[model samples]
Target chain A: MNTTLQQFNVEKIRTDFPILQQEVHGKPLVYLDNAATSQTPTVVIEALQKYYREYNSNVHRGVHRLSHIATDAYEGAREKVRRFLNASSLQEIIFTKGTTDGINLLASSIGRGLIKPGDEIVISAMEHHSNIVPWQLMCEDRGARLRVIPINDDGEIIFEAYEDLLNERTKLVSIVHTSNSLGTVNPLRQIIDLAHNKNVPVLVDGAQAVPHTAVDLRALDCDFFVFSSHKVFGPTGVGVLYGKKEWLEKLPPYQGGGDMILNVTFAGTKFNELPYKFEAGTPNIADVIGLGVALDYVQQIGYDAISSWENELIQYALKRLQEIEGLRFIGNAKHRAGAISFVLENIHPHDIGTILDREGVAVRTGHHCTQPVMQCFKVPATTRASFAFYNTKEEIDLLIKALYKVIEMFS
Target chain B: MDELRDLYQEVILDHNKNPKNYFQMDEATHSAEGHNPLCGDQVEVFLKVDNERIIDISFQGHGCAISKAASSVMTTMLKGKTITEAKKLFEKYQHLITAEMSEAVDLHEYGHLAVFAGVREFPMRVKCASLSWHTMLQALEEKKEIATTE
Candidate 1:
């Protein structure tokens, strides 16, 4: 490892993860399942344990000191998220259950109000089900067309084809910033610009992107960005949706409940302002604070360094898996993140995954919840081994060694 | 070899590589397809039955070693058996793999399938191993309902 990347310290970083020090089937665990959800750091877990131990109270309505402290921590997380994504204001950041709930909130609120009959909502074929299902449901409800941007053989969105799909009827263009299955980092800056020229808003699903790369919402100029905290090495049940203040104010409230309301007389009630208006009922308070710690953890290590290190891991993994005969990688995108997907001839992905698991190397097998991308690649599924910054080249070598055993067994 | 001995025995791998009764019967009376989307296991079971007796049975699909081997072993045992007898075999095989009736299963008849009897220990793979059996049941139902309808 380079001295710059070693500032994060792989051994020290692994120490923070208690699960990493353990064994699976009498062998040391080699976890490569970051694309699903990353292993949480000690600071994130301690933050959650500390919150429940003390200052455990519902936020936003208390006058006591504990309640006040809890409220500050909860809202402080929103501010951290706002800064992390480089959003214009704190009001633009709304807490959600996860990326799925965030996209659904946008689809129901903004999508219902803006998308009309004969309008078009564009999405890429490489999107997760969370990104695809919401827009699909919205389009089916409204008499709108769900246009898909075709992906190239490498699984990146075809930019020219996406630009051609944008027209006067295009109301929204939602896409994944990085494909979960393929690890293709899409050209969001250009995609957002083209949609803006057509006067259409765009939503970038940053669930996979946020973990490996840094995002600046202002520079990207997209209307909305959504990501889950768990994928970013934080606790689950906490996520953030960053939207422009102007766009958020124009849209309807997401869910109607106690916190979202100002006055309820059963006839007509006034709604709360921007961020709170979107957040209904009680939110995942402890996890939200843990998300702040997770962001602070990444900031301390530096995302720029983390990105380069993960890219190196991806490259090393690709090269190692390539050396195994009859083992072909599925997604070979040039501008990819930290996912390595492949298939072995005469060996099913599940079998490969199982055999690898016995050797203490874990990898995800099958469609990876992106069925359309699987269809685009014309393979039923691929075994994916995704990496985090803490991952080492030695781990990739172990993966290759185990994969060779799998290939030989089938041969 | 000892490391892979417990999971992929020689008999199991042999059956997987050169699967017995593995072909497509074009003039099959019963055919059904089954898929496990979670693992991307797909199996199409084709059976040729004549007067309530299975004259031939084969499978054509892609899957894990356990699934491929399990289906091949089931086909070898079920060929030339009556539909009712095959249904009984299906039940016995299900019980054998699920560890419901382990001691009762005869190893001589089951052959390589005896290796799959250990599969019940691995719960997650039980679905992959049971996929072809599910397709067989589906084919049996299709034969019953469609045959009556015709």
Candidate 2:
């Protein structure tokens, strides 16, 4: 690692996000809903504008000059993603609509082809509905059993139980690297290792993890990883799915359409190679290119600095939030990333969210697409304040103050 | 805090804390469960009708003040009224909040429900306020209303 030249500046970084400058309900917007979707940087917005403004042509097939430029930019984005996750090859990365689409693509394709009766698909209790439903549908289709590894009170996955769940019958072990609800960062290395021992493939839901921390596919050694671009400062409707070459090649295509086929006749058709086979349609070229720019922006900032800044923000928020009376903080996992779930006694989560929003503080207040997780916690819903690198302690203080107001109103 | 207090008036809070007709009715003709997946507000509405008249009504649940108050008031107002009258009252009450059938509602008799009129300002809470009423309608097997899990 090279010694840092210029230290990361939080104030300078905040200026890059145009939406953050605006006021909502008479107060400055303190966006804490980054886990849902991050606000795009000016560079990313400009990239999208530049694409439509300059090279607005269909990619891959056209022999025209603009087509070549468009194709290059689109494929260039793929290379950026290839480096972003530290995947061994560009062929491993496939673009989908978002994280849900990516997981569904894997589950529908591989789960349809390989999984059989009596086989088991192991998933953790912390999985989003996107991760859980696809496996459930696949298992239902294949006569395979769906097994869940439960989480502890601390919201971390019980690694011992996860190991116990892994056996010869386990076909796939899909788990979220970082939980969206609890901010629990699961032990993926041990999870991958245990699954690999049983000749099972592991698909990591990296939607929450990719935005907050460094994700090295080579180091984690997971067979598959998926994350959405929107959650990481890029446009919505674009996500990256990285799979080992062998696994992707063996699995069938997800959706059959224009771009994925090499040659088609009345009688038969031949599919295109690796990622193109999976992509299968006119992709979100502009957004993917913009995602490349977002990745570039993050690379410029550097993850180590981002992590340190966010860790400080989280610690500060947690300490201050602890002081409010009747404010019960949920998900007290030792290892966390940019999420805080809690409840103000006698106040509905929706009310808390409403008041917070009125104070120009945006937070998620619901089951967060994880109804089962809410069941485990024995709460109907919780107000979740998720942070990002651009977020400041000032914003966290604003949240604390607003939450205090909510407590007073409800109690 | 005052805005929230305005939303959760003394009447709403009084009902929320010690709700009127808050119990399971014995020998009830119909009972239905209202579950809001979003906030986890689960309400069970029990109705006892005699010759199309709601002789007694009650509700039991765990929820926010708005939901609790809505159910409590709904049960309180429905008693001693015919099923048709109760249906009309629900319509007038809903119209008062949603501004859908505002013209039909007198807005005087339904004054307690007026506190909930602000509920329409918050779209998400609209479902929370209506969950119990929709559940009650479902228990009565009224075909016009639809029960939803918010």
Candidate 3:
């Protein structure tokens, strides 16, 4: 509808996603829930199909042909993830179920190795439940205290509060990269640097970041980073945890199972080296390969193009949504990405979500798994319409129209 | 759009906009909280009973329009009804809301409650509509735990 859409060639990108082509209810589907999980592109879907159709076997176990082929593709995905994050080595990349599984892995390994009684682990108020709960459980296990860094009214983490939270007793700092509820992109380099100064290892929940922005783990200097495959246009049940080699070696194995061992006996078991030591069982093979194809898919499109298009869409959405009477934005961070959450006066988010769905506009309406952030904003929930590269400016207009309909109905 | 209107009819909308008995009952004899954790909607049902009959019923909480309206109409229906009658009406209302859409809803039978008959089409909102009734049941039973319409 405007200049940015013309340059991005979103029509071409939309065609790559088959789900976006269909209609919901009676209208064209306007999928704006990219923060939950991006729609899988045809390339990723066909890659999944080809793997099962051709080379479907367990990885690094059998010496047969199909097994070898599957192993190569699986390991090749690790290499792709390693390069995608610009990690130092393939041994530093570990595959897990998703971001939740990755955090649970770290909580277990680090809880046993590093945390002691009376120690403190710091997380921000905007963290999703996945980031918050694991640390709480781990802290309970190790007799450590969970300290929360408060965010300002705009959903930006109070940097001073974060600084005050880190001290001699602070063992680890875990924080979100881009808030799923608030759309605020936290300053990671600054956050990580501040933690490192206090000898605290920082683990970043990059679940909302990697798809919308470039992440060079080496450049950011974060000790650990995690994101989901589905959020990055890959298959579900697959995710990557990028850890530094030195840290991965020090942390204990997360689980005990097949393929994560160099040698095992009834009397004793010697855990495998760096990454596989953490990856304990039959990993998600097809989806991992799908994740590689997804990485290739994004790299081909380029993050610059994706960010610019989504930026335009978000700006347009913010401007148009403001046109509706009694509409209020929940988060107004100076730096935001891909998502915009708002509330209509005297109308619940669920009602807005229902009306929007009737118009075939899919937006997430809830606390977005960040209840603390909701408390910070002093609302029960907000209607969130997150974007992807394939979303057009016209879709934002549809959302605006649906929102106006919500106002009419409620009035 | 017709389907949306079916779900949010004028009756429901009016009840939502000007909810009845929307207050905290400090002198209530029995009260229970209902929570829909998925959407963060909550309601507290309060009752004043005299000789097994509800003399007064009111509700206070935060939730969607369906929930607020449903709660308001529920309070109006339950006032001056016996405990047994309240339970019977709850069963009938629950059956109506959870009933199959293919079989037409008997609008005359439910009266005020029929406004919520459209909720069954939207499966996710059914819980929002049902939360108050369950919380009222918890209040009647004198249960300490919060009721959840998950």
Q: Largest DockQ belongs to which candidate?
A: 3
Q: How should the candidates be ordered by TM-score, best one leading?
A: 3, 2, 1
Please give the CA lDDT of all the candidate structures.
Answer: 0.85, 0.87, 0.92
Query: Which ten-residue region of model 2 chain A has the weakest summed lDDT?
Result: A1-10
Pairs of colliding residues, candidate 3: none
Q: Write the number of the candidate with greater TM-score, choosing between 1 and 3.
A: 3
What is residue A108's positional error in candidate 2, in angstroms?
Answer: 0.7
Runs off by more than 4 Å, candidate 3:
A1-6
Writing each residue's lDDT as its tens digit, candidate 2 over A346-393 gives 777877787888789999998899888988888888999999999987
Native contact fraction, candidates in order: 0.69, 0.50, 0.96
Deviation in angstroms for A376 in model 2?
1.2
Ranking by DockQ: 3, 1, 2
Residue A25 in candidate 1 has what lDDT? 75
TM-scores of the candidates are 0.94, 0.95, 0.98
Give the candidate order by descending lDDT: 3, 2, 1
Kindly indicate the candidate among 1 and 2 with the higher TM-score.
Answer: 2
Tens-digit lDDT track for model 1 on A315-409?
77877777777777777788899687888877778878888888899999988999888888878789999999878878888888888788777
Candidate 1 docking DockQ = 0.56
Among these predictions, the greatest lDDT belongs to: 3
